[model samples]
Each structure stands twice: as C-alpha cells, then as structure tokens.
Target: MVEESAENVVPPTKGGGKKPKSAAAAAAEPVATSEAGNSPATESKVPPKKEKPPAVEAKPFTEFIQQDYLPALTQALADKGVSDLQLNLERAKIAIKGFETAPECSQVIGRWNGGNRQFNVYFFDDNIQGQRAISCVDLGHRASTLEAFVIDERKVTLDLLVAGVVLRLNSQKWLTRN
Candidate 1:
C-alpha cells in the first residue's frame, strides 16, 4: 500500500488564479471614469427628494372584529362546546340550556407530557361527563386547582386557583407566573 505524504497534498491559496471579481465589488466600484458623463459620487451628491406615499385609510374596529376575530373565535367556541348550543364570538356569548348546576359545569381538560401540554374544553350535561381529566404530570409545577373563563371572543381568561406555577397548552405556548 502507498503511504500518503504532506508534499503530495495541495496547499490552500489566498486567491484562486484568474477568478472574476465578485458582483458586490463590481457594484461598489465607480461606474464611470472622469471623461464619462457622470461619476456615482457626483450623481449622488444632490439626491432626488423622496416623495412620501399617500396614507392608507384605517378600517373601523367593528369591521375589523367582524372580518378577523369573529370567525376564529366562533370556531374555537364550537370546538370547545357541546352540541345544540350556539356560540357568538362577536358578542362573546354562549347559549346552552343544560349548564345550570355545578355538576353541569364546562370542563377544560389538560394534560402535560413532559415536553408539551395538550388541552381540550368540553361542555357537559353532568359532572361525570364534563369533569376535566387533568394529568398528575401536568399539575407537577401547576396549581392543584385551575380556572379559566371565556373572555371577549378573542381573549381567554385563565386563573390559577393556587399560584406559583407553570401552565401550558397544546394550542398555545407555555405560561408561567410567579
């Protein structure tokens, strides 16, 4: 077998022979000589005044809410709630006939799998059906009791019954409060 030696290896060069100058260098160089029409420096000396574009008209809040926030909120509410109920995101209202007592409370189940958390909200007719299934792992750094409320269509109200913990969700990023 032939042995490899340092003398046979080619040494790296600072500049490869006869390589063309980079486009950046070409662009940076002067475009014209003294005899030409104008040099870049002279042309740029008295720069043309920039005219500002006309201001765009702002959309009304109601229009914006109807167009954007309403649809998303409506879908989220439907995904969370039970059947036979109508949810209006624009008005921030949920209409359900069976949720009158504690046992019939809406349940928002959440689970944490070390790296991430998954959660789902359900509307229940009875305590057994609506009871949230919270994992022990999720509650490790979280409060024993967790509370959340439906807010103005776009926002959700999440409150920890016990403080000093981190709560995370599959749909959202992890949240922490001291």
Candidate 2:
C-alpha cells in the first residue's frame, strides 16, 4: 500500500467499509444434515467463491480513480464543457481543459496523495486591472466552494463527490466569483 500520512487520510466510511464476504459466509439456505441420509458422493457442499477487489498496493491511485471516481464524475463534468480532464492515476495531479492560456492563479488547481487516497480541488476566477487584481481566493470563497470540504461525509462515494462538485460549480456564488 502507498505510504499514507495523516494530512491526506480521508475519514473512513461510517459503515460497510470491509471487503465482500466469501460465498460460504453469504449462503442463506439450510443444508441437509447427516441424519437425513445425505450421501457425500451425491451431495455438493461447495459455495461459489466471492470475487475480491485487486489489492491497492498493486496500483494505489489508478484503481480507485478508474474503478470508482471517474465513472461517476466524467459525464457530469463533460456536460459542463469541462470534459478532457485527466487524472494522473499515478499521482494526485490533474489537468483541467481550457486552463492552459488562463493566468496560473485563475486556473483550476487539484492536488492529491495516492497513499491516503484523498484529494482537493479548487477553481479560481480573477480579474486584473491596471496592476491591481481581485480574485475568488482573495475574496475568501465559501467552504462549499472547495471540493474537498463539500465532499466531507462519513461515507463518501464517487457519486457523492460528483454531485457535490457539480452543485458547487453551478451555484450563483461560483459564477460571480470574479
């Protein structure tokens, strides 16, 4: 597993954080006992095996993004003309479409740590006037404007994060940031 520091450790989900149970643990039907003249030669006792998720250590960030977050968030961001965003599965880095020409301070910012499997996203809007500047970061954007802050929950799923990000981007407050 990637080495996770406390700074990027997302809180664990409130429930159902463990892996799926093996089929034997999930079987619900009653089986015949020896008293019922059950013949070992004619009886089947094996249960179907449960599939396990690949180990995180194999590809820490890639698996999570490919299997969980991307599927849920891709369509939504595409609908907003922000498609083409790519998560560097190897790291917490990202590339947002249409940010190349924008001032560095006005571009979207994303950072993450694979070990802790947590990330933060920020979008800044700024206007420069005759050597003066005003920006969302300077104005003190609200807590909800942050993807990480909005995604805080005991049980955070990719779908939940997608919804939160979409909502924040579409809000009037965000639109008027500059």
Candidate 3:
C-alpha cells in the first residue's frame, strides 16, 4: 500500500514554493510509478537549490570601533554594574581640549572608580563615520560635552552602537550601582 503515483506528483512551484514539500522533497524525487506496478517509471527531480553563503563584509568604522564597538561597550558597561573596567583603544598624536585634529587619531579611554569615573570616546578623525565626542568625569565633576554618532540616520549595528553609549550612561546616573 505505497500510494503516491500520479506520475509521483510534483508540479507545485511558481510561487507556492515557500518550502513545504519535503519528505526530503519526496526523497529527492524519482519515484514515478512503483510499489510493484512492475517498474518502468522515472521523472520528478526538483530538489537541489541551497547555495547562499557570501555576504558578511561590514566592519570599517575604524574597524567597527576597534572590533565591534569596543567589546560591546565593555560588555554593556559590565552588565550595568561596572567595575575596574579600564578600556582603551588609543592611537593618539595628542590633543583633545575641544576637538579638531587629525594627525592620526583614535581614543576610547575609559577609566574606573579609582580614577573617579572617567570617559572619553573621542575619535578626532579616522573617518569614524563622523561626529563623536563625549567626555565625562563623574565624581570628579567635569561634565559638559557629549555627543556621539556612528551613523544614526541609517542605523549601524553592534547593538545600535552599544545602545547609544548605554543610553548616555543610563541617563547620567552613570550606570548607577555604587
């Protein structure tokens, strides 16, 4: 009782093909009219299209801010608790008083508690996709300038640029938890 023989039924493509005909596509077809109707059948081949693997090539905002937005914003600010965490990607030629240089730039310097909480994402110009300047120093005061970008109108990832600097340091509580 093997049934399945109207020439082994196979004509359903042309839009109704969102992949739903598998028994491994009827065992990769060719079972025309058998089960002892005395052989002599064959013709139903359609299953051999699986070749898509070549599209991952985006990482150039200064190598995605030194390999994926500084280790995913230092693991999302060490999961919000933040500790020790001294991150740096510096490649400086010095000078960041108010920004405006390019003799070879790069900066990510982030210090921790002992340093009285600090920050400085500045990337003066290595074509870091433009506009980036943040400088914070919590417990030690100094907090006025802040502005960041790595493509916003078009949305670039790495979890939306580390959730826009962890939502501006969790809206200024500077990632609380102290």
Candidate 4:
C-alpha cells in the first residue's frame, strides 16, 4: 500500500458521519422518546368522517300523468262503458262521445263515429248556438250537452286531479285562465 493522503484521513461528519438510515427505517423509528429513552405508543388517532345528505328528485309532467291520471281515467272510463278513450293533452282535446272537441273553445271540433268521422264544427264565438249546426251525434252538432261540454272543458283539470292524487299531488304547480 502506498502512503495514505491527508484527504483520505479526514474525520467523519456530524451524527458520527455514518450514512443516514433509509426513509423506511427512519419512518419506523420513534416520534418521541420515553422517560427511559424508548419510543412512545405508535398508534394513530383519526376522527370519524361525516355522512352526506340524500339528493332530491324532480318528475316530468308527462311522467306524472302516466303514473297518476292514466290509471284513474282508465278505471273511470271502464266504469262508464267507454271501451276506450284517447286523450291528447298536447292539443288540449278530448275524443269521446264519438266526437273530439278542443277543450279551449268551440270553434274547432273533430268528430269520430264508427269508421266515419269529420271535424266540421265551428263557432263565431263561445255562444254554443252560433256554432255550425250538426247532429248532436254528428260532426255538425251545435250545442254540446252539459256532459259533453264538461268533458271537453274540464278534461285537463280532471287529468290534473288524477295526476295530483296518484303521483305527487303537492309537487305540481300551475296556473289556468278561462
């Protein structure tokens, strides 16, 4: 062996100049020293987590009708000897009593009977007698009987009632003008 150099004989650095322990070993070491120079309890204490609230759901009008009004109307029609009744809320019209009429007004009427149907009823005003004269059972019926009138005029309200009771009665809100 050659003569050792002064640089090679240098003393160790701080902490005895020995290589520091690895991350894993250091982490496993004690956070606090005991009275006797030993590690304290190593268990961690974590607080419990909070729970979240539930979400609310909103329903569409058509869904409300299907769930509520449709069933009730089906039953009511069955009780009234009406083998079938088609309601068009989109057009606000009712096709019943072998005829169809707009619930809004008497100006336009759609008639359906057996296989022959016509929509030829018109009125200058709400006055029932002023409408185009048609058979009470045909396309040109003038005065709509009380029952017929109510069916046309109140169909929407009836549908609403059915929907409200069966679906979410307190959930629906609307405004009507006569």
Name the best candidate (by TM-score).
Answer: 2
Say which candidate scores most in lDDT.
3
Q: Write down the TM-score for model 2.
A: 0.33
lDDT of 3: 0.66
Model 4's TM-score against the true structure: 0.24
Residue 87 accuracy (lDDT) in model 2: 40
What TM-score does each of the candidates earn? 0.21, 0.33, 0.25, 0.24
lDDT of 3 by residue, 29-138 (tens): 86556564433523234454799873222656566677777787888999988868888788764344453464655778788878887777676665455556666766
lDDT of 3 at 24: 77
Off by over 4 Å in 2: 1-32, 35-59, 81-148, 172-178
**Residue-level error in angstroms, candidate 2, position 120:** 5.9
| 1 versus 2: better lDDT goes to | 2
Ranking of all candidate structures by their TM-score, best first: 2, 3, 4, 1
Return whichever of 2 and 3 wins on TM-score: 2
The root-mean-square deviation over C-alpha atoms between each candidate and the true structure, in angstroms, is 19.6, 24.4, 16.4, 18.7
Off by over 4 Å in 1: 1-29, 32-59, 85-178
User: Residue 23, candidate 3: how far off, in angstroms?
Assistant: 34
> Of the pair 1 and 3, which is ahead by lDDT?
3
